[model samples]
Target: MPPPGGTPDNANYDVLVVGGGPVGLLLAYQLKRFGVSVCVLEQHEKEMQDAYGRAIALFPRTLEQLDQLDLIEPMLQLGFACRTSVTYKDGERVVWTFMENIQDTTYDFVLVLRQMYTEQILREKLDAVGARYYHGMKCVDFTYDENLPRANYPIVSTFVDGGSGEQYQLRSKYLVGADGGHSFVRRHAGISFEGDSSDDQWIRIDGIVETDMPLNRSYGAIESKTHGNVLWAPLDHAATRIGYAYTAEIAAKYPGGVTQEVAKQEAIEAMKPFKVNFKEVHWWTLYNIGQRLANSFSVRDRILLCGDAAHTHSSGAAQGLNTGIHDAVNLGWKLALQIRDATKLEVLKTYDTERMTAVQQLIRYDKDISTLMSHKWPSWYEGDRNADPYHVLGEIFEKTASFNTGLGICYSENFVNQTSALSLRVPPGSRPPDLELSTPGTDQKVRFQHITRNIAKFWVAVFTGNINATRTPLRQLRKAYAGMRALPIDAFVSWITISASTGCSPYEALGMEPFGNTYYDATSCAHERFGFSLERGGIAIIRPDGLLATGGPLDGQFVEEYFSKVMQ
Candidate 1:
């Protein structure tokens, strides 16, 4: 018998997020942290979150973003910090490196962990944060109307409980589809997933295993003759991920079709001279590689798509999950800002604009990387066919290393990223370098990222130059900012002041009370790192997602000017 249908007292929310994967959960978690009531529905039960291989790596930039949410510390405890990779040929060690190009952040290594654990951490924190989370409850149907009297809660979604056979409706101001690539929400929302699919098949197997190979604990690959590029990566808890191309040769050998045994045997074959023994097999998968993106991310001003639901691509670059994290981080604050101020509809548009473009760039890189991994040269490969794919891959990887690490990801000029007068090594729409700073009285050092947690506010960082010399501007800025302290954007802005000394007291460092948080750039390296002089300080507006909005000479007018365009 079907359970009763009724909108429970807690049914209504500010946002209804469909899908409870890492992306959906993180987005909902952030929305709740930003004071927005949210509901996250995942059709799958917790145990079934990921029974097979999915994303296994978190890049440096993503780690930084997670730290911004204060979630990385627990994640670090469950993940392996991978800083080195070594490739081998015929059991001979060969030089190969990854993620060495990443800089400006304390999270400088690729974190190796299972997707389930990552999801578990998110689920636990989501509960602690008090967001509505339901597993085995699927969004069966949803509708929206601008004509509704409660325009703030115009989205009504009906969800079916898998266990009880019960159904009910939850209303929200907007609906976000974080469902995976084969998204029911995307299809229902009439959003078209557009892109190309390739016939390349790949296999990934994860297990607690023993390997004779040196540096087996790090990320490495074998130059497999039969299986193309073979991946060897150490995961948390003594497990290793073995991945290789499931080419036609492997299929031919498995005329009866492949099984777990085939996945195991082929992995052994791919490793060649390296000894392999699985103590316990955990998860494995055979999947096709494809690249696709939703034609639209935000729809009808009331619906949005994120994570795999908005874009899809091969996992060749280890970017599938990382890019999704970026999507959620980018969208979370914007959604929070919009939900708080409905008139700020313009900010939501940038989510589609920025992420779509970024994901498009990701697909291009993955396409090249995927084709190379398939042991096939792309059509654009003008080089000799006899050239080693590894060599070509190395060249391309070196070129795209910064992007691959998520540090070089840049956005074009928009309302959020406008022209700035301050000449900084980092440009607008790019992330500022993560440097160390000291506390006022305690003199405790902290990462700049640790200071600017993503709290759904524009962090106005006022660089108060050597207070002994530039105290006048600090005093002047203090006066100018008073007139704008209670502006309409107060709900979305934060303040921090940094000076160039490890003064025992914050008041002595700035010659006045600091605006928000006070930090000391002891050696002024943080200033030089951001391309500013400690002798001549300035102001920088960092968006909630940690991207530098704009910077200018020590003045509050620049910040006001930047927000004028954003709020307008």
Candidate 2:
């Protein structure tokens, strides 16, 4: 139960992640990558591990984040590209081919893979990082001790072994509640979840089927009078998901409750213009629609909440698991800094501010989409009831295309996002565009995100207008890197110089020993895409999470000021 050794009383850990879901394991993996002592406690036994009927579609931004971890290749191999979406009303096609406009990203299409497979991939990464993952461990309760000496490990958590019923206590510097919607940690911490539940219920089933209707592997939606609306998508393992809403009459038919027989018949009836037969049923679920958010994400700066423990919404937009993954990555680096004593405790507050803002916007979006998909008009609606809902839903889908695609989610200006030094189209709080560049040493081509995989250092990218003028800025950056006290040399910050001139080799000009690797912008694409000037180079401080923290002229004072906000 306790790693085959006797349980130690009051065990020590840098961070205690209270759930073993994707979010919790991700948090643990990131923390351990930076050498932070972290452990995950999950109540589910080893036998029950599989995709729990959660999210399946991964947006472009999520894929980019995974790419930074070097975890995107395997997922791409296992998942199929869902690049098109078609919508119909009463068996007549109304809207066809959505997502054709999102072609600017590396992952321009949604990757359809089951959540269970995603968990398996994350578990492999977690094991590679050597993080401790414990299953069948239940966290019964915990105590927060702010007044205790050496507040580094101020939280005491008591847990019961799910396999042996043995009880023990653990001391950690911080606690994270990545537990799902029914989170025990959130309740124990006295956080209030605020939201409303809708009367709309839906059934989703994954199976191999035979149908006369065209079920293109691409995503599709059908608006029906008897069954409400239906969402169809191709899943892995020769299976596809067919989900439909329960209209008033449909609900009345199953007064005694829905069964496999009833669900199959309802699904068949929902597809009115076609004949359907199910060969095998992989998984099926009945879920109610609801939206909720924790009033506060942190309790006195000691206990933190993330994932479903912090926010909950219906899966109509496929935002539940994607949002949770966002939350995990956003909080991972900030927590690592606090544990390493590299930054002030106040930096942790930004996690709540940034993530809460994103989650609130997500809740509003999910509410609108779920309401329309359920075939229910708003209570204030006075329009004609005969009008097709597909027209209005399609309009909303196009309007929020950026946000729904995950690339449009940006954080508000905070201490981390000090100010913009470069007059670029991309703002301070948004992710920098991925650009291609070649390594000077190996002459190898790579994306800008490839070198940003490490979470321990801030990538100070200094763009030089000319090779002759690069000496001064590179010297200043080297000095700034030397004086950085956040962690240690190169571990806390790293520098890369990009020159616009093709004739000048960075390895030959600037000493390659001081700078890890230099880049050359031969075609000037990086210069044009990043809003950097070919005549006048610019400086951008890329945070550990790849968000542009600050952009400005290459001056030591500006770099010093930015680090001051994070270090002290």
Candidate 3:
């Protein structure tokens, strides 16, 4: 494996990622795992070390997806396990149960880790896989050609080495901009960035702090008449994140503009009635919020975008970083499949369709939360002028609890998430319940996602409701699935037979060899969570990113039909 800041071994790659943040690093890592030649270009000389960056919360679904990458264990070690949320006004508790509504999965609590550590962990994984990301590299400009014979490497990207001030070119089959909001690639490529910017500016400071409020180590908010809705989040390593709207009136107090000292002072004032003292300051920022989405996420499908390059929004709901993670995982597998078989280009198209829909939903939610956090009603508000923004914030907050936590993000029908009877409770396009299962008779517990590792391949979960009742249909499903080798796309799938019956092995328990890998739903919780009958079995097609693609009865032909439509 090349070192973190090492030179690329080759100038040409199957995919060239333009940013080396968490999203780009993870996408590159996943593509490399699938045998795709991938490299990343990062403008920063190195990932952040001492200073923590903007994002701090990783919601439930984000953690679940990270677990699929086998990266969550390290992150959990560095994050604070925050379980509850509290809001206060003048030291009195205010009821807001929106954040407390997160349910299901092992990662029920939000993992509160700084963005710098998140990026570092991703880079470490990328390094272990030998994927090279060049540092101090800036993508200046580039052009593409389809008329020429070198159409396979359609996108030619030009970069300037930040260290040497030398310009160079690298060719790739695809160019992805995981770059930040002011993406050089997006602007240079002439992609339209459409959205509105709020005059509301907010101050967020990360530091070691002491606070008298209970649930200080968890998520907390304060209604400050002067500071608006104050943010009091407990971050990793005994750190507290204090944030408040840097209102125009407060800005007027410092016409020279807010300094780090000013930011620190304001944080203390924001948490009035309850005292807070900063022991150490790690990082802080004061900036205006905006919500922008690219008119298109892909330019001719060769020049694609993800993460902040495709969309930028407020940290109010903390969707900014979580959405980036979603974009990376969603794009990683699709791009890898497309590169492996050019005929499956449609799979790559679904990344844009899927993420754009999710992004639109996020933007609509952010517009309200961001305004509310600043103690202002959104433009759509029709209630009385005397209405409290915090009250309104509470109502809207509860409704979007599932989405804000990322557990309920469901995509529209597409090739990857095809329309079905939607029979299962965890239907196509929705995230599957990460219920616990066990090794066939060992009875050792294992998470459903652990069995479905993130290797840019789909996981076919054969839910055998009960061995005694469904053995015949299970065997028929296995034989029919075995016969699918003629299609070629079947190679991209991994299977696990989960039986509701527990025994020594598949042979001893079900009178059949393990279909692919034998697992026992010892408690029948997995079967129940998946909406599978205790007597009748079925199959679920889990996409590479962990969303259920399509599912139906235990009929191999049904499974084959899905793959045939999604891929050759």
For residues 103-128, could you state the per-residue lDDT of candidate 2 as single tens digits?
Answer: 55678888888888887787788878
Please give the CA lDDT of all the candidate structures: 0.84, 0.78, 0.84
Model 1 TM-score on a 0 to 1 scale: 0.95
TM of each candidate vs. truth: 0.95, 0.92, 0.95
- Report the Cα lDDT for residue 1, model 2: 17
Answer with 2 or 3, whichever has the higher lDDT.
Answer: 3
Q: By summed lDDT, which 10 consecutive residues of candidate 1 come out lowest?
A: 1-10
Task: Give the residue spans of candidate 2 off by over 4 A.
Answer: 1-10, 49-51, 90-92, 150-152, 380-385, 441-444, 467-489, 508-515
For residues 1-568, what per-residue lDDT tens digits would candidate 1 score against the true structure? 1112223344678888899889999999999999999988888876765575578999988988898888998889989999988888878887776755457789889999889889888888888888877778878898888788544588888888888888878899989999999998899989898998998999999998887888888788898768888889899988899999999877988889879889998998889898898888898899899999999998886799989999999877788899999999999988887877732677778899999899998888888889898888988988799978877877777888888889889898787887789778778999888888988667777988878886577888988777777788778888868866877667677898877765668886666878888888888887887887877888888988888988888876776777777874
Model 2: weakest 10-residue lDDT segment is: 1-10
**Residue 299 Cα positional deviation in candidate 3, in Å, after optimal superposition:** 1.2
Candidate 2, residue 526: lDDT: 79
Q: Judge candidate 1 against the unseen true structure and give its global Cα lDDT, from 0 to 1.
A: 0.84
Candidate 3: regions farther than 4 A off: 6-10, 47-52, 148-151, 485-487
